[model samples]
Target: MNAEAAIDLLKQVVLFALYVTSPFIVLMLLIGLLTSLAQSVTSIQEQTLTFGPKILGLALLLIVLAPWLLRALTEFASSCITRMAIVAG
Candidate 1:
């Protein structure tokens, strides 16, 4: 592929990765921050307290967002495949 085409592909790949991962990562970050704040307020220093909530939140988030995430990835993959076919043709 030409330089411009390669750059575009890289940009798409980065965007797709961010789109797929941003939700879970952001959720975890927010949960961690909130949990820290709660712990600070309540003076509970249990290490496991944060883990359970974060995991459960992320699981729930994944369940809720799975369909949209899957569809986006599928579409991106399909488009990439189609582009590859056109390039090869």
Candidate 2:
């Protein structure tokens, strides 16, 4: 209801989003790093070489994490909805 409480809720929302997306982001980052390293070592200049593996990895990651992501988001949504009344007044 108050500005402080609203700010706290915003903080929680931001943190929850970051937490939910962290795994996927980290996965992509590592993939890209390895791709860069291999490209450097092999002296390969093909730009598209990394795309396939990254795409496949991202797809697999999404498939693996989808359920967990959904559950976390659902829980966050449920909690926010349940707190709506308190926040409203």
Error of 2 at 62 (Å): 0.8
lDDT of each: 0.88, 0.88
Q: Please, what are the lDDT tens digits per residue for candidate 2 over residues 18-82?
A: 99888888988999999999999999979998899889999999999899889988999999887
lDDT of 2 at 35: 95
TM-score of every prediction relative to native = 0.88, 0.91
lDDT of 1 at 49: 99
TM-score for candidate 1, residues paired by index:
0.88
Clash number for candidate 2: 0
- Give candidate 1's total backbone clashes: 0
